[model samples]
Target: MDGTPLILTSAERTRAARLLARFTDSYENSLTRRPIAPDEDRETLAKLLAEPFPEEGLGVDAFFADVVDRIVPYTTTIAHPRFLAYVQGPPNGIGPYAEAIAAVLNQNCNLWQISPAANVIERSIMDWLTGLFRLGPHSGGLLTSGGSGATKDAITAAIADRRTDFRERGLQENHAPLVLYTSDEAHRSVVKAAALLGIGLHNVRTIPTDDRFQLRVDLLMHAIAEDRAAGKEPFCVVATAGTVTTGSIDPIGPIADLCAKEDLWLHVDGAYGALFILADSARDALLPLSRADSITLDPHKLLYAPLEAGALLVKDMAKLRAAFAFSSTSSYLTAIDDAHLLDYMDHGPQLSRSFKALKVWAALRTFGVGAFRTVTERCLSLAARLGEHIADAPGLELMNPVTLTAVCLHMPGRNAEAHAELLTRLHEEGTAMLGPARVHEQACVRACVTNHRTTEADIDLLAERLIALAKR
Candidate 1:
């Protein structure tokens, strides 16, 4: 080995920095003009897959060249103004810098001894989120990989809290069949989590929803009563704050009331729409979120932080610690007594964690919370505007009521294949990228304005083009 091959020389570092500057500069400057998604080049892609690793390092220039040329050109431009296919959003301007710094430091965020500042930063972030949801003084949580993991972890706590023997006996040795309640409109992550945690698909009730796509509380109560009569134990109820398809929110207040009466843990999967609470228009609908026993919200979607930054806020910190902690007396992970400090290992599934809090913290501090609220409000307004346009457009119709940013529109006579074809055309023609969805089992297209770059012009153009193209 020639003088430590891993560490770059000063000249190499300079070259790498210049390349990164050029790459970011070019990307930001031409983001709008670029295609939302590049057409697939199978031949070029196959070469990448077939390529072997080289024994020697490709100098800094060649490595940068490959990234900017071979890799980037083929990737979907999610930052594009018209890339409105899903709940995903472009990262805030500050998020990238914070991510870079986080990478540079490479802090292990498991314990205060290893990452003192990171531990407090994560704790402070959870405090703010808990306060935002009005989760009361006893609440605490930790950053997770995403909402799915957060939901799973929340359910873990639910089981531990309800069944004292959970740590010892687990689901296999349970006395009765454990049932978890959720709505038809709830995320697949709920079912997946239950199934993974050995709750079984049969025990997870997917109650039907009303015409508004909201979970029917009456049906929920009926199901719970039936389960109880059948000698099954109902332990937790998973509610949706914002559904993936229509952005529909379940009736959290009534559900909370039911949960309180039945002593069931209420976990609100707010990954898609919970952050809309920041906007004044949606505050009334989302206010009941504070009543939940646990919540899963994604900072990546609402705050525009980079990916892999989802939050799980629980009603009581002790419950979460009890569910996940190995032991408070673990020799290696023990920390000095500090009220502000939290060993994140005791709060969630992970022991080795990234400094995910920094990217979110940086964005909040740089842009201010008001900026996020404004962006959220604007996205809601855009969705309403789009729905109105679709309603006014002849031969096109709104498939669902525009409540949040997801606007689903239908062509009156189109079948499933026809709808799929329309989506393909939308992408192929570079008109815009919209997702295929089903409103009450009828196929439609969904345009979600999660991108801050999406404008009135972008929405109008997509609507007009869609109107003109549907006849064909």
Candidate 2:
């Protein structure tokens, strides 16, 4: 053969297709088919990977075999129905195919000229989300990596919108130290974002939460007044729609009122709970989201899209543009955009963007909003059931209210370390994978029913295991 680069020919394509089909089949059967206890790799994967890379390709067949033989077994099965850990669950049925299609197209979603349909699709998705929250006509947003990025974008926009001369002088300018506030129950992203933005940890105040784990509005108001009196610029207040540990919702309405009076930017970290607004009850609970200047939400968590699907929505879109659209950059390789098109580069920090909107749009269209609502509602109900079971059990105590989809339970007589041990035991037993959370300074095993695939039986199995563990 000549020194020409080895490309996948017809035979290689057929082999690849067959290998992919096999992989998909294995994944589909993973739910009912459990891996062997003390699972062992019949082949040594380390040795295979440790070999030096060959300048000449091994061709497609050997590559596919290596992937199937070595890589597949060692991977944790997140798609498995029983694998419930952190705020992550299972991906929706259409998500995998949509993601594959996106990869195949490889559309750079930076501008409409490069990806016209993608730009429109993202805009449509954002419009739908904004309408869902009842955020009026001027509402717009940018798709982000995940909830962390979304929250960071929200905070950035808030800062940009509030500063009187931020356009001319960045945060580098010496001014009264800017302070931001969030409930103790808010996600750590708020504190991290503030720190990353040059707001010292000392400037980020963690307001106390009430018995329900919601932020105390009175305390927040007092903090604002104190900051004002101290000659500090209190710029933003981050309210949580769903906290990580307890799934507690902050008092957004009262918080918004304070922001309005104090002229503070209001950003809601709704990464976990905002999509629950698909449900009538959840929507009713989140009425205050519309009042916020900006909000962060994760489609990956609630919409059941594949990983890395988050969004930051602002009531006024210009604030987002003002924050990020400074670097006037042009590329000869990229097409020029018309006034009719949306240049997504102006929306967020990234100039090269992936077609993330495809999976989201595909899921929404395939399952429809009604299906998402039903799934979200089911997750909430399942959490409630699990919480009830934990409450009624002899040795277990519910750590917090199961407001959204998180059920935090602890063995009352034990410490955090013991709870952690129990969590390990459950995972080892193949019952489920539950995350450990510290709620109100107590160690608790946390199970978040965020998957559309989670069922009553799954909740029952989790509760049964907990009850058995507690009794022991």
Candidate 3:
């Protein structure tokens, strides 16, 4: 009773741990039966939103009860087996435990001296990822908040690589406007990154895609030449390994060749598709990823790590340091010279970084690499199976090639509104949660097999429901 409320007694800590274990067990068991979308009670939610914080503290038991009764029922069950919507899914089994451990330790991973173990763990994770891409001896990277942050940082480095005086003169003082090229199918992150980094939207060329939704390398070459003729400095080309809408992979090999010929920095956005390299079926298509100057990856997607874990891998470590490292005049943050250890603060934009790498490291270590490979291969197979079912079904058309784990389908007679209606019905009826997408201006339904919990039965059930809906 003498201790502050913030510090719980040993007996209270034991009780809290027991409660957490029980809640986790119950939730995991209920995931399959739970509705994919929440049935929101608007009145209750509005009241909760307007509620003010009390001066008196609620006991841990009452707080736990509130979470179980109020919060849990109103949250979307992304872990549902049939919850096939976007490039997100439930975290791996080890993720939550690792997250809890990281939270308890609360280590600031900015500098090696401050958190030696965390620094080493992050370095190890980066080394493993770089090895996956076969990035050379000089290659290294750092964890980011997500794919967007990684892509933004990659573009920043690309600018530094192209403009020697960029650090001093900045974009406003530059003579020629630097340009970036990416396929129309590339994630919006590329364009967003350009806009954020002072590269105007006009400077970012959206190259057309081929019949298969892959980037047309011929058009890309032509665009680069046209920019050069127009007195614009073409500096970077972003290639997509996994597109968001259809999971179409851009032609990386030819794009790499083009980049090499033009001396342009190549950054591959592999946030969704790159990790599919672990699958034998996808290895050949993504083998050319090693040729990229920099690559962005999201461990949360395929690696089954918890949210907010992304990374940027660069072939030359010195370039990444050059892009971000700033000499701080603060006496408290003296640079340490340890060859084996890295000060993460000098490698990225953030100085106060969290232990985001811990969950990723734990997942890889606990489940082993082969487990992830198996899950990825399974997802690919599931997508292909779903595509086949859609093609064979009456009135259903396969909109895009099942290149990876995203299957795009369309009803012959239905428009965008019909597809939207079907998606809404599926969620409301608890059949399955699918997303609506556009393929070449035609509306389609998209199911991404990013969840490891999903099975063949889940796919068949979803397909059956969709076919019934379309027929009606």
Candidate 4:
């Protein structure tokens, strides 16, 4: 291979662009007809696995051909309109172009001097998100890898806020065991964060929820008091805005009040449902989120952005800075003293970050906020329709109230294994793709209508197929 082959010439660039355009157009057009899950060909897959990396490049044309023939056929079509399995969906139209731009620029967004334009764009995006939640003037945040990362960062800040010497002494030096509180319905990321921070599973309280699946505020208070009596320090409470299983939103208002009374840091995990605030119907329910000390959001979920875009917002930017910022004495990263710009390295763990904010910014700017709001509202409507259909169906039961875009359904005589099998059958049959869930110890099927492309016809088809399958 020659050195000239490494960089694409103008003609090569144009050819590659044409190839990408063709692929995207075909992919989008075939989404509805494609199977939700691929039938794995073990023999072909083995061959692919055994293939070794070549010393010479295959070139763009051959590489694109391989992607189309080998890779695309064996992938789940999550972008399908009927793919209602999880809280994920296809990327918006502008996402790919913005991603390409970001990749070409290869901006390292850790410092202002290194990525001045990217830094400004990220700050602007964060500002818009914080403004949506009414997080106040001093509020600020940084983009993260995903909701898990954002939650972990928020918990770290909470730890620092509660224990000033956490940086030096770590969790071992604390006089008393620090306990973290979250509802049982909360996402597993909360528990994961607690464990990763060395708080230990024993010190993490999983308070029970009420019949509606909302966190029981009374039980939470009791748990906190009990922990305090045992000489354990209760420092932070993690609440859920939109849970994963049934889309149950914990009572943020009551949780915030309790956190204030107990002098505990309140962090709302809104990764699945926070962006629904853009919908007018969800605003009232999520309004109390502003009272939280910190919040975690995923733009990839509701915003229709591409994968791996998550964020953490703090009411007071100083708390986040205190948690992650290091005063490096190194001459290389000499801090730039500019109030208008920020050093992203001070906000999170990664010293080398990508321009993940560009895709999000581009989508928002391209389609405008109103377009997203309409799609979000439509998703909620579709979920509600599914819940209604489930309730009226002969053998199906509505597991939880359709609070957002997730609807859980139960077949009367189905066990957990049976529900799993039914989900497999649905995927195989290509009627639709749904997930399995346990609702109050009973097996159920979960359909999350987060896909913007989903329509009423698709919902009807899913309902009809599910009813027919249940009768079998």
Model 2 misplacement above 4 A? 1-7, 35-51, 327-339
- Give the residue spans of candidate 1 off by over 4 A: 1-3, 328-330
Model 2 — TM-score against the truth?
0.94
Clashes of each: 0, 0, 0, 0
Error of 4 at 71 (Å): 0.7
Give RMSD to native, each candidate. 1.3, 2.4, 1.1, 1.2
Alpha carbon lDDT of residue 198, candidate 4?
A: 96
Q: Model 2: which ten-residue window has the lowest total lDDT?
A: 34-43
In candidate 1, which residue pairs clash? none
Q: In model 4, which runs have C-alpha deviations exceeding 4 angstroms?
A: 1-5
lDDT of 1 by residue, 1-472 (tens): 5586688889988988899889889999999778888858999999999999999878989998899879988999999989999999999999888999999999999888889988888888898888888999999888998999999999999999988889888988748988999988888999999999888999999999999999999999999999999999999999999899999999999999999999999999999999999999999999899999999999999889899899999999999988887765667666665677888887888888999999988888888999999999999999898899998989888988788888998888879889899888889888899999989788899999889988999989998898898766
- Residues 75-115 of candidate 4 have per-residue lDDT tens digits of 88988999988999889999989999999999999999999
Reference-based TM-score, model 1: 0.98
lDDT of 1: 0.90
User: What pairs collide in candidate 2?
Assistant: none
lDDT of each: 0.90, 0.85, 0.92, 0.92
Distance (Å) between predicted and true CA of 472, model 2? Answer: 1.1
TM-score of each: 0.98, 0.94, 0.98, 0.98
Q: Estimate, for each residue in 103-160, the C-alpha lDDT of model 3 and write its tens digit.
A: 9999999889999999999999989888989999999999999999999999999999
Query: Roughly what TM-score does model 4 have, to 2 decimal places?
Result: 0.98
